[model samples]
Structures are given as structure tokens and as C-alpha cells.
Target: MTMIGAQLRLLAWFVIPATLLSGCAPAIRLDEAATDRPIQTSSAPPAAREDAPAPHRPPSPTPTPVPRAFALNLYQEGDFVPQYTFDWCVAASIQIMHNVIDDTGGGTWADRVQQGQLWEMARARSSNSFNGANPLGWAKVLTEVGMGPYAVVSIADYGEALRTAARAIADTGRPVGLVMWRGRHVWVMSGFTSLGDPDQFPKFSVTGIRVQDPLYPYGDQQWGPSPAPNALLTPEQLATQFVVREPRRWSSNLPTGYMLVLPVAKA
Candidate 1:
């Protein structure tokens, strides 16, 4: 019985120590600051990669670009008239202009007698000492007879001169009278081809000019051949015949430059 009691006490001591060792183990230490922060649980999508194409929504459609080229021409059949005499260019120009403005083919004025009469009238109104009609008289005759409200305009730059004439024709829908051959001749600007439509594009430039030289097939000895009616002339081809006016050729307050018997919009 004593031996049995001794064995029991030893076993109890072992069991008691095992229980104490497990129950008294030290707790793991935690960082206080880390523990105080809230967990991030936002449902936002991940950031897109820099090189990724835009999401399923298609990128805004690029605007449809305008056509890079354009053209406008007002010439039609029977719009051309030739001068009856060498000195009747202005008169012939007037007839052609009337025909152009009278697009309906009503009252075409290509009569030779009328041409002679018109020439005499222009010569009488002009004061060019050489007995030839000048740009001022040409403009006056156009205005006086209801074909006008025309004006003589001079441009310093050849290119700008062409632009102005083209713009005038495009705006007024009437022909522009070019004072060709150093203020000695006349040609009608009927139409033009351009990089952009003059009415739409601000920076439009002229690519070709349509001309009506009353002296067609009978071009001057100095200037080159006259282009047929409604001929599309390149800017370079036109510069040869259409030159700056010799201011001394006529009396005027205008500075020496390129000239035009420009059509004015009626009020």
C-alpha cells in the first residue's frame, strides 16, 4: 500500500507540470500601430496599363476630313465672244460679261453694231490722251448701262491679284475683267479650279484660271497665244500675259500694279 501511494504521487507531479507548461506559455507580441489601421476593401477596378487600348467603349470617332481638293467653274456654251476690231476689247468683254450674267440665254449681246456703238461710247468717256478707252471708262460703261456697279481695282501682289479676282467671281457669280498687257488689253475671268472651295475654305488657293480672250487665235506678238474660251490656265501660264500695269500708260490716282475691272455686288 505505501509503494502504491508513492507511485501515484510521482505521476501526479508529472501531469501537473505538463498542464502548467502548456497553459502558462507567453502570448505572441503584435505591432500596435499596424493593428490600429483599418483593412482596405475597396471594390474599384485595377488601374489600366499605359499601353492598353481604350476599354470596350470605342474611342471617339475621328472627324471625317474634308476633301483635299475642290473646283468651281461658271463657264457655259456660247458664253464666249470675240472682238470685232483690235480696239474693241472692252466692248467685247462687256458683251461676254452680259452673256455670262444672263445665264438663261436671254438677250445675249454679241451684235457687231452694238459692239461698235459700245466702243465709241467708252472711247468718248475715256480721257487716255491716246484716244483709247481705259479701265475707268470700262467700269463706268458697265455701271451706266445696268451691267455694272463695277470698279477698277489694283493689287500689288500678282498672286493676291489672282485671288481677289477669283474671290470676286465666286462671290458675285459674275465675270472679272482682267486688265492684261500692261493696261493695254482685256480678258474675262470666267471660272477657276482651286485647292478648296472658295466659299467654304478660308485658305483656299487658285490652281487654274479659266479665261476668255476676245482675241483668241489672234494673240499679240509680244504676249503668247490666247487661250480658248473657258480654258483652264495654270498660274505660271497666265503670268506671262497678265503683267503689272504701266502706271504711265494712263492718268490715274492708283499706284502702279495689277489691275482688274472688278464686279461689285449690288446693294
Candidate 2:
């Protein structure tokens, strides 16, 4: 009985120390789901911070572009007449102008009867004793025919003169009386081509003009091919015949350089 008791007491001492040591240390628990929890992360990228502000952006600017081309062919509308004689250019030009604004074909200024009347009226107001017709006289007659408020615009620069003429014609939808041959001859400006849109008038530049030279082919030696009545003339080509008015007994009162019988809006 004493030996059995001693063996049991030794076994109890060993078991107690092992149990106390394990209890003093940590307890380890095994979970089958723990490994999967770490690997089960989302496949999507990380979301942006909720408190972050958006970036700023500036506004786009507005556009203001010029046009490519523009033209107004009044002659093509059958509102032009050819001169009967070299000296009758003023009368013919006036007659053609009358046709344009004369919406009613009352035959008031049509044919030789009315043309002769206009010629005589122009001659009566002439500044030159030599030539019965002149720019001043032409303006006078035009005023009498209700196309008044016309201006005798003269510019030294050919390019500026073209812009002025283009703007006038575009605005009024009427022809401009171009004093050609050093103020000795007259031609009608019926249309024009522009680098910018002529329809935008006052805001464009002239590139070319369509002239209704009454003397045409007959005066080709003096003015190039006055082609088909309303001939397209470049600034260079026009400069050939559109020279400064020579000081003459007739054109003494006229301004030098390029001149035109510009029609203005009636006040």
C-alpha cells in the first residue's frame, strides 16, 4: 500500500506542473475559416475618399471667324443699259441706275426720249463749258431723279476707295458711279468680290469689282476687256484706267485721285 501511494503522488506532481505551465502560456485555437477571410478581399480597385474636393476647369472661348467669299450681281438681274455714244456714258449710266430702283417699269426714264431729257438736264448743270456732262452735273441730275443725297467721295488710296464703294453698294443695294479716265469717263459699279463677306458690309474688304463700262469693247484700248458689260476687274486692272483726275478746265472743281458718285441713305 505505501509503494502504490508513492507512485501515484509522483505522477500527480508531474501532471500538475505540465497543466500549470500550459495555463501560464497561451492557448492556440485552429479555425478553418480564418485563412479564407484574408484571401476574400474585393477584386475592385479602392474607392476615392469621400471628403476629397473635385478639380476645377476653365471655360472655352467664343469664336469670331470671317467669311470666305461674297458678291452682289445687280447687272445680271437685267438692270443695265449700254451707252449709245461715247459722250452719252453719263446718261446711260444714270438710266441704268433708274432701272434698278424703279421697281415700277413706268417707262419714265426708259428709251432715248427719257435718256435725252436726262442728258440735257446733266448738261445744264455742267461745270465745264467744253464737256456738257461732269460728275457734279451727274450728281445733280441723279438727285433730281429721286436718287439724291449722293456724295462725291474721293480717296487717294485705291484700296480704301474700293472698300468705301463696296460698302456703299452693299448697304444701299444700288450702283456706284465710278469716275474713270482721270475723271473724264464714267462707269457703273454693279457688283464686287471680297476677301470677307460683302453681305456683312462695313466689315469687309474688296478684292474685285464688276464694272458696267458702257464703252466696253470700243474702249478696250483704254480700259482692258470691258468683257460682257458687267466685267469683273481686279484692283490692279482698274488702277490702269482709274488714275488721278488731271487738272483740266472741266474737272478743276473735282477732288483728285479715285472718285465715285456714292449714294447715301436719305435723312
Candidate 3:
């Protein structure tokens, strides 16, 4: 009888615990419950545009800047003591030209050319035959220094080089003139004239403006107003002319038979 009573007590204990556990709700899963919460949605605020500057537009039909005689005098000093070698001078000039432009202000190539200080700096460096005669090579150097004009590759194309240079000159707003020397006589471009023949003396413009003065002995001439005179020369022409005419001229300080001066177009 006592054994039967003890067995009944043990069974009662097991049953009570089982029943209590089964009656309880699953421990509310906090992770799942949180996931059931709704997501909040609101439109993001628009970006601020208060401090933005206006976009820049390249000037079209820009004016060309003319170099003053005083500036020319800076280059005409001494018997052309060439500092720039054909290979090195052209490279150095392009770099220095762009640097000076950036130092003064950030604007189009025309803007830099118009600046007297930049012109003096460029002329001083480029005139030294130490640079190369190949303008395209010079363009490569210009790119490194951040003074590229975008269309500089045109120089590789004979017909396009002069036009490209002309356009760049015009954009620079500097003296839109060309300088050339037949022998020791240096002439400045004045204006273009339709010589009636587009071939030999092609129907184009001419550059010259002689100032009569004995003290100065002779004055420089300026040329311009033509839409396209550079069309005459092709890329092969430039390479051939510069390369063939005087293979050693560009490399040396001695005059390379002829000297051509090209200025930026008038702004």
C-alpha cells in the first residue's frame, strides 16, 4: 500500500510540470516580432545649388590682340642669339607659354596671348632656336603643362596647322599677325590682300606695315583680316619644309635660311 501511494505521488509531480509547460505561449520571439514592424518612408531633400558658378562659353569671332612695337623690340635685340635649339626650344616655349597664362589668370588661349607679360615670356623662350621646329612636338609639351588649345593636333596636318594656329591666335585675343624674314630683314604682317591669283601669289591676304623712322631705321609690318591663308600648306608641307629646308637650322642658333613669325589671332 505504501509503495502504491509513493508511485502515485511521483506520477502527479511529472504530470503537473508537463501541463504547466504545454499551457505557456511560445516565448514570444523578439527577432521575428521586430521584423513585422512597418518601414518609415519619406522623400529625400533635394541637393543644394546655391554656390555653383555659371558655365563657361568659348568666345566665337573673337578679337585678335596686336603686339606693340615695344614688345617686338624685346625679341629683336642682338643678332638673333638663338637660345632655343630646334628640338628643345619649341618644347620649352610651349610649356612656359601655358604656365604664364595660368599664373596670370584662367581664360581662353586668346586671353593669355593678349596679356603683354605672357607674350614677352613666350617670345623670349620660343625665339631661342633651342626648341624643335615641329609644332606638333611642341603641342605634346603644351599638353603636359595644361595650356592645350584642344585643336593643336591640326599642326600635324600641313593645311590645317596654320589654320589651327590662326584660330588659336584668334581665340587668344593676341596680335593676329605673322612675322617672316627674307634674309636679315624682318617684316611684320599688316593685312591680307586678294592678289587675284590664289596659286602663286594666291588670292589671299598679305601682312606688312612699315614705319618710316631713321632712328629706328626700319619699322615692322602687321598683317591680317584673311579668313584662311593657312590652307596653302598641308601637314606634309610643314614636315617637309621644316625638315628639308634646313635639317640643321632648327638644331642650331644660326638662322635657318628663313624665319617665320606667327602670332595669335586678334581677339
Candidate 4:
């Protein structure tokens, strides 16, 4: 009987714990709970570029474009006039300038009689010019006859001289008078082609020049040949004939240099 009672007590203890353990929500083990979520991993950063500019320094400024090809021309079909006589070069040049600027259909000033009268007018206004029209006389006659407020200028440097002439023409819309062969002859620079626009850039260079030589087809032996009218001559070609004026060749306050009958703005 004692053995049977002890067996009943042990059976009751095992059955009661088994009934409590089979619950509505099961308790998960530590290893089983770890596998419920996905594993998270970290990676290294990318390498930097070697060619990039420094972060602390400011960026450099963009440079202005140079040798940007440009051209400006004022020559027309009928803007050329040949000299009536060897001594009437300036008069013919004045006539050509009048023809260029006038733009009116009928009153062309290329008549031989009119050219002679203009020569006389220029010569009458000059002094210390040996009875011919000098630069002063040429400028004065232009002013009086309503062609200029022109003035005489001398530049020591050849490149600067071309630049000055180009700038004046671009500024005033008038022709530049080049005192060719040391003030003995004259050629009118009607327009020019440059590396940059003269009106826009102060540092432009003259690449080619358009000239009107009154003595075309009759070039001098000592000096170079006269280019055809409205010829676009390079600076080197022009340098062959264009030289420094002799100080004693003509009387002026200007020192010995390349002479130009430059046009100035009217005040």
C-alpha cells in the first residue's frame, strides 16, 4: 500500500508541470530568437579623384580670346580717283575722300578742272612748303572745304602707327592720310582688316590694310610699286613704301617719325 501511494504522488508532480508548459504562447530559445532577423553588414568608402582642384582655393578667371579673326572695310566701287597730274596727288586724294563720304549720286569730284582748283586752294593755305600742298595745307583745306577737323601726327613705332590710324578710322568713319615715301607722296587708307574689332578692343592688331594710291600703274623707281586701288596690303608690304619722314623734308614742330594726316573728333 505504501509503495502505491508514493507512485501516485510522483505521477501528480510530473503531469501538473507538463500541463503548465504546453501554453497558448510558446517561449523561444536564445539561438532560435537570433535567427528571426537578417544580419546587417557595413562597407568601406570610395577613393577620391586626384585631378580635382583644391577645395580651399578659388577658381581662376577665364582669359580674353586673342587673334579672333575680324575685318572691317569702307571701300565701295566708285571710291577711287587717280591723280590728274604728278603734283596733284593730294587734290585727287581729297576728291576721292569727298566721293567716299558724300554718298550722293551726282556730285562726284573727279573732274580735272576741279582737281586743279583744289590744288591751288591747298597750296594757297600752306607756308614753308615750297609752293606745294603740305600736310598742314592739306589738313587746312580739308577743314575749310568741310572734309575735316584733320590734324598731323607722328608715331615712332610702326605697329602703333597702324593701330592709331585704324582706331581713328573706326572712331570717326573717315579715311586716314598716310604720308608715304617720307612725306613726298600720299595714300588714303580707306579701311583695314584686324585681329579684333578696333571699335571694341583697344589691344587689337592690324592684319591687312585697304589703300588707294593716286599713282597706281605709275609706281616710283626708288620707292616700291603702287598697289592697285582698294588693295588689301599686308603691313609688311606697306612697310616697304611707308618710311620715316625727313625732318628737313618738310617744316613742322613734329619730330622725325612716320607722319600721318590723322582725323580728330570735332569738339
Candidate 5:
């Protein structure tokens, strides 16, 4: 019985120590930052408070981007007549060669050549004949239009002219060339080709082909060499022949757009 009592006393001592140790455990504080203050409470004025002030959002709609006007250093000084880009630059060139021999208008080939009228008026006096009609007809039309034969076409490069026409007609927008394919002759380029890769330095380039074919007939009705020859004129050659021809006389200022007549024969 005494041993049993001793065992019971030992158990009580152990239980008392465990209870006292647990009572000495550290206290963990929660909700330390919590406060009873109302969410809206503030000392500053309503305007000065960050939450009270109204948000200054950017104005409703963004301004629209205005399109840049077409501009260039080259400008037309004389008078202007409408012209087509591709047909005149290409097909008309072909017709010009054909008309040279067909004698369609009783040796009036020169007249027909100048019939381009308002069309070829770009090159001051030089481009006039290429337009169509003879020098006399051109003069008559010039009088009628109140513009002299030496009128000026719009100040524009071949590329600009083509783009304007293409846009008007809903074209795919390819830079067209006045491809005058023939055997061997002086290449007269009046059109341009877009530089395929716009990222390149030169965004566009010129291509003027002279009308010469193996079958191309001279004034004597004699056949030339082979037909459909390679490009006869390089850009430099054309520049020397066409662009540099009396450069001081007329302004080569290329405008954003130009005018041209669709060559009737090619169409």
C-alpha cells in the first residue's frame, strides 16, 4: 500500500510540472494591426485624399492621324495635260513604232504620233510630239485648250503617275514600265518600276525601252533585225537621252503624281 502511495505521489509531481510549464508558455498576439477606426476616416480634405480624388483618365478618344501630303523637289513648270501611266509608257510606245510605217494617215504618221496631244506635253516641246498628232494638230488643240503646244504636264515622276491611275482604277498597284521591246534602237524610257523591296535604298527605279524589232520597218519598208529584243536602254542611257535633254529648259521636279493618256493602240 505504501509503494502504491509513493507511485501515486510521483505521478502527481509529474502532472504538476507539466501543467506549470504549459502555463509559462509564450503568448501569441493576433490582430495587432486591426483597429476600430472607420474606413472613411481621414484628417485631410476630400480633394487632397488619394482615395477621395477622382481619377484623371486620359481624354476619351485618341486623335486621328492625318495623312501626309505628297511632295517632291521636282515640279512641273509649264502646263499640264492628262496622261495614262502604263498604256502611254508601254503600249503607246509600241503603236508609235507601228504608226511610223502603216502610213495610216497619208504620211501623217508624224501627226498621229503627236496626236498624243495633252499626253506627251510633259517634256516641254519634246514630249509634245510623243503625245500624238502632228505639230500643227498639237498647235490647234493647244489653242483650243487655251494652252500652247509647249504646255507643261504635271510635275510628277512615272511612279507617281502610275500610282495615281492605279488607285483611281482599283489596280493591284504594280509599278509599270514603258517596255519598248525591239531589236536595237534608241530606248526611250518614260515609265518607272517600283523597287520590289521597299526596304532597299532606292524605293523605285526607271525602265524605258526603245521600240525596235527585227521586223521593225524603217522608212524604206526594210525589215530590221530580230524581233522582241532585250532591254535596249539602261537607266543611264535613258537619262542621257530623255531626262538630260534640255534639263535647264523645263523643270524635272517630280511631283507626288502626274497625268498621262492611255495609248489607244495598245489598249
Candidate 6:
């Protein structure tokens, strides 16, 4: 074979084999720009969590204020009756009670006598002497007249008695019979005052009391000066006349202490 022909045959043999091998192999591609960028491995996007804590909120406002002090003066609306005789205080007090409660459809009794008759009836019922009427007798007479259903509360604590009397007066709008001076005399409880509002009486401390004193300035010398009718009396002043449990000189069966005639529901 000629030399040129032999050289061309050898080149064709090398070139054809290389082209066939390249066609059989897989192609590999690379980008220079891709190597410069940061690799992001995660598929999820950035977002706030649903369970995260909420922002702060302002506090709620306070409720309405309550009253701290109060006073109830029932004396101005009540009737005042003076006892004719020293021992007739209970009768006189009952007369006053009748006058006040009569308008409210209470005080239904055939024996609505002013003083003498009531005194007699109380004395007879209680088995009391002519000296004076006893608390039991007074309460019994009031109950018999339909003016009651009265309770004879004998209490040793003065403050408790005062509270009870005030509550009774406020609830019934009737005078409370106060057995004063260790059962030597009787007075009426008409009203009261408190450190807290009167409407919230159960929550307050009683500061003062309005009383109807039948004896007034002319009380027995041994019992101290009687306060004027419908007088506003301090606890200290009341303590002067009011005493703890003591036996009575007239009645032997009566219970001792600060006694009161509290009206209750009929039957």
C-alpha cells in the first residue's frame, strides 16, 4: 500500500473507536455559579409557631365602692309617750309601740289602754307585784295583744343586746322593750348607727343608739339621769344605765341579764 493511504487508514481506525465509546457512556454536567451559592438542605419555609405565647394584656378595672358608715334615725317617725308613774314605763313604751305600728296594720288588741290598764294586765299575767312589771309579764302582755309573738331575750353582753335590739327595731319597725338598770326599769330602742352602711347592718359595728326613755330627766336617783325622749345615746352613756345579769327585787322567777322584748311573727 502507498504511505499516505496507510497513514489515513490508521487515523480513521483511532477516531472511529473513540467516537463510538463516547456515545455509549453517560454525560456528566457541572456549573461554576452553583458552587458559589449557600446550600439550603431544608424544604420548609421560615414562619412563626402556632403555639407561641401571646402578648401582654392590661388588667381589669375595679368594681363600685361600698359605703363605710351609716345611720338610721327612726325616732323622728315614732310616737313618744311619757310614763305617768315610775312603774308604768313598760306600759308607756307599749303605747308608743302601738302608735308607731298601728299604721302598719299591727297592734290589734282589745286592751289598748294607755298606762294603768296595761300595767294591771302585765302585773296580773306575770304574777308581778304592784312595785313594777317584770320582763316576762311585759312580753306576755305584748304577745297577748297580738302586738307580739314577743321574745324575751336575756343577754349578758351589752353590745350583743344593743345589736339585737337595733336589728329588731329595723326589721319590725316597732319599738324594742329594753329592760334597763338590771330589770329596775324599761326603755325603748328606736334606732341605731354603724361604722358600715345601715343597709349592710350585719357587717358593721354599732356606734350609737336612738332610745325612747319614758323617765327622761326624772329617773330614779339610784338609776342615774335618764336621757331625753328619742335621745341619741353613746354606748358609754347607755352602759351607765344598762347592767349585766342581776336578780330582781320584785319578781323571783325572772331570768337575769340585759333583757329585751323582741317582737316575732304570729304563730
**By lDDT, who's the top model here?**
1
- Candidate 1 displacement at residue 71 in angstroms: 1.9
Q: lDDT for model 6, on a 0 to 1 scale?
A: 0.75
lDDT (10s digit) by residue, model 5, range 1-267: 999999999999999999999898754434533454347677975567666768788878976543332211111111111113322322233233323323334332223355344434522333232442222222233334322222223324645433432232122211112212211122212223332322222223323232232222221123223223233444444332222122222233423223222222111
lDDT of 1 by residue, 71-97 (tens): 667778887889999999999998888
Model 1 regions lying over 4 Å from their true place: 1-67
If ranked by TM-score, best first, what sequence of candidates would result?
4, 1, 2, 6, 3, 5
Against the reference, the lDDT scores of all candidates come to 0.87, 0.78, 0.32, 0.86, 0.31, 0.75
For model 3, how does the per-residue alpha-carbon lDDT over 1-267 read when each residue is reduced to its tens digit?
999999999999999999999788576678887898799877998776999787898779866543331111111112111112222233233333433344344532323223333324444433335431343233333444444432222122333333433333334532121212211121222122222222322212222121111112222333121112112332332233222123242333333332333442322
TM-score of each: 0.75, 0.75, 0.25, 0.80, 0.25, 0.69
After superposition, which runs of candidate 6 have C-alpha atoms over 4 Å from their true positions? Answer: 1-67, 104-113, 129-131, 197-203, 248-255, 265-267
Q: Which stretches of candidate 4 lie over 4 Å from their true place?
A: 10-18, 21-63
Between candidates 2 and 3, name the one with more favorable TM-score: 2
In model 1, what are the clashing residue pairs, if there are any? Answer: none
User: Which has the better lDDT: candidate 2, or candidate 5?
Assistant: 2
Winning model by TM-score = 4
Error of 2 at 226 (Å): 4.5
Tell me the TM-score of model 2: 0.75
lDDT, candidate 6, 76-193, per-residue tens = 4547778787778888877776665677555432243547899888877764555557777888888887678787877777777788777777667667887787677888887788
Worst 10 contiguous positions by lDDT, candidate 1: 25-34
Model 6 CA lDDT for position 203? 49
